[model samples]
Target: MQPFPSQPLDHDSLHEECGVFGVIGVPEAANFVALGLHALQHRGQEAGGIVAYDPERGFNGAHRFGYVRDNFTKASLMETLPGALAIGHVRYSTAGSKAPVIRDVQPFFGELAMGGCAIAHNGNITNAAALRRELIERGSIFASGSDTECIIHLMARSIQTSIPERMKDALRRVEGAFSVIAMTRTKLIGVRDPLGVRPLVLGTLHDGAHVLASETCALDIIGAEFLREIEPGEMVVISGGEVASVRPFAPAQSRFCIFEHVYFSRPDSIIGGRSVYETRRQIGVELAREAPVEADMVCPVPDSGTPAAIGYSQESGIPYAMGIIRNQYMGRTFIEPTEQIRDMGVRLKLNVNRALVKGKRVVLVDDSVVRGTTSRKIKDMIIAAGAAEVHFRIASPPTAWPCFYGVDTPHRDKLLAAQMSPEEMRDWIGVDSLSFISLDGLYRAVGEAQGRDGACPQYCDACFSGDYPIPPSDQIANGGFDPEGPTTLSDHTAP
Candidate 1:
């Protein structure tokens, strides 16, 4: 077992989502997968579980209501969840309603119209309610309010001849984004939406074992070498210890979420062969090239901003120091039960190291600012710690629209940039000055195609540019933002 390091989670993460892992063709797949999921514990800490299958016992699982480390110890797992293939989940509810109820745990299983299957998914489905209605009319009974349940029903009732056929039908029918790992008595499958709005990777162990996960970090933890990224609209199936690929969707263009590099994915993990560390560093390099500042020291918010802070320091010749310390034990701000608590979440989430910033002219490097409340507090913390001056630099463009895929971005009016200019935001956050990387600069930071200027062709820039690939219908948005009733996919599901 790995040592657990506490981080004051973005207590006001203001959003929720999660990570997932699946391993096939290994004798002790669940054991290996548990370790892998632990590595990605930072992606989501709400709940975790692993489901394992063997031809003999079939579908055995161990689930719990806390962090992966809090449950499923190595000793306890030896007596349960023994199998050659497995799937795991770590959730931060982009859809599920609030409640620490264990029923919200994943690797949901049930008897299918054709047979039985178990699934754990990461991402949001925009058209789930519509799909649920369509399937409910066909006599489907759902156990969860999540859109993922809709996929389960669709898979069971599909007219396709094979399991992959049924999955493909379900995939084609769903809108929004999905990076799912599912299993049947005989098959293991992984899929991504056509837009690649979310991330999914395919990898292999030296023993010829196949693995699939939402982040490459999972594979790294379990000693699996990433084979390649699962292409958008592609599905990989493992049956009889052999792997097969299926590309059922037409050749639509790809739009890998660019934010993955900026905020998601562990810096140590690689996506599409690009190290997240290098990517964030590149963002720092670009930020420096686009907006250079005169300051005494460069400091990062904490955790996610450290690598970028190092990059900014390297590029700008500013000395970097550990200025902010995250209180690893805090829950996500978004996970906090009340709005007042969320607004104050950051104060408890991090502490300004007075020794590092006292009387120093500080340059603050962060990935991005959302509602600006969090950043505003960070500035307050720094000023209270005696910083002489503060300049803020963001690694990505300002988010102008809400994300339609899985990202739980804040609403339009709550956005700092929407209501105020950079100067205004600087004043609001109490920073001496603020400058954000340009869209062109952000593209360069991520290594966009040559000669393409700053646009990321394979990037989903809808949230920043208001260029939504598939805009949400008005009624859908109404239902989506609802915190009460069964308005949200999470609210309808078993929270």
Candidate 2:
């Protein structure tokens, strides 16, 4: 048992997605995984778990509720997880219960006929409900509410004789986005689903140990050299310091999530060989070209909005100032959990730079406006701080639909863009003007020269375009679930 961190203050932003990390052929592998997960803490703050295997100890696991730093950093706990092969997961519960529980924490372990195998997964399983029902009827007992447990149960029921073979069999029967890292007594494995909706990469340490993580930033923290991205539909297994590749799923078009480049990933990380920071900065450039506005100064919402704001300032030749200052020390602020207190989060987390924006026409740049609640509050704060005008420039296209693959999002009706046009949103938020980068412009910024291909999109822009590359099986199975109802896949199934 462990202490659960304070619940994050509710705000208009996408929930943090999960992150996975693994290492093989290294001493104190769990320690390395801890550092990697620390770098990925931004992706998930709810809970974390790690599983390691040693010759004598076999499989040792630790599951805790809260940030990796608060739990995994303790030497007393890390000592018990001694092994040369380890894998870990940081979770935000897109596919499980919202309330914190050790059972829902991941790097789920199972004792197979071949050996004890552990798996850590990033991304959601769309078909988890049906799979879980079938498994339960077949007498499989579930230990956690996470959809990731479906894969473990499938592996357990596989007819294959080897762990990797069993994993292949299990994944073949599954559908939806996944980038998985798994471990056996002698091997470390990584696999990305055919569409590649989530990011995963391979890295190598100086001592020749291989690392697999959801993002390159995790690799950076462990001083691992990124070898390459694990390709879509490809599975790589590392044993005895050697890596082998196999394609377990049929080849399909790649649809990596474009949101990773927009807001989910750390700007310092790389995706598809392009720098995420550079892409966001380029997004600002595109936004400027599409919606040039006359303003005294351009300001960012701060933190996530900084890079794009810099690019906007550079492209438009407008003097950029710190119009809004963020309180960097603030972590979770829902200790009171009052509705009024929740509404005060924007003020507590951010403050307008009164001296900088006293009477200036300030253009406020932010990644995206989800519910418009936070944006409205920010605009009011700027107005109260004496800003003459407030314009909002969103770096990504308007989020019109909820994401089904890993990202935690509200239902269709709750989304601001889904209900109102940009002009209406501007009026509702009381901003002087509001604009979001065009879908094609976002594609161009991310290196798609001519723009997004309508028939075969280069990336998954489902949240923006409402074009899901993979059919959400369970949602469809739910008889095209009511738009007004709770929308998360987990909400429709048993936890």
Cα lDDT tens digits, model 2, 1-495, are 111112333536797668999999998999999999999988998888999999998899999987788899999999999989999999886533466778888899999999899998999888999999999999999988889999999999899999999999999888889999999999999999998889999999966699999899999998999999999999999998899999998778888999999999999999999999999999999889999999999898888998899889999999989989888867752365676775566777899889889899999999998888888889999999999999999998889888878998877767889888999899988999999999999999999999999867888888997777776889888876533343332221111
Error of 2 at 141 (Å): 0.8
TM-scores for all candidates: the values are 0.89, 0.94
- Report the number of backbone clashes for model 1: 17
lDDT of 1 by residue, 1-495 (tens): 111122233422334377889888888778887787888787777788788887678778887766777676667664578788889988776533566566667888766666667888888787777787778888988776666777778888788877678888887777777899998877789988777878989888866688888888888887788889999878889877688988877666677777888887888888778899998998888888788988999998887778878889999999989888888766543366666664565676788889989999999988887777667768888999999998999887876567767776656666677677888777777788898988877777788745123233557666676655543543355554433332223211110
Task: Kindly provide the TM-score of model 1 when superposed on the true structure, using C-alpha atoms.
Answer: 0.89
- For each of the candidates, give the backbone clash count: 17, 0
Scored by lDDT, the top model is 2
The global Cα lDDT (0 to 1) of model 2 is 0.87
lDDT of 2 at 436: 96
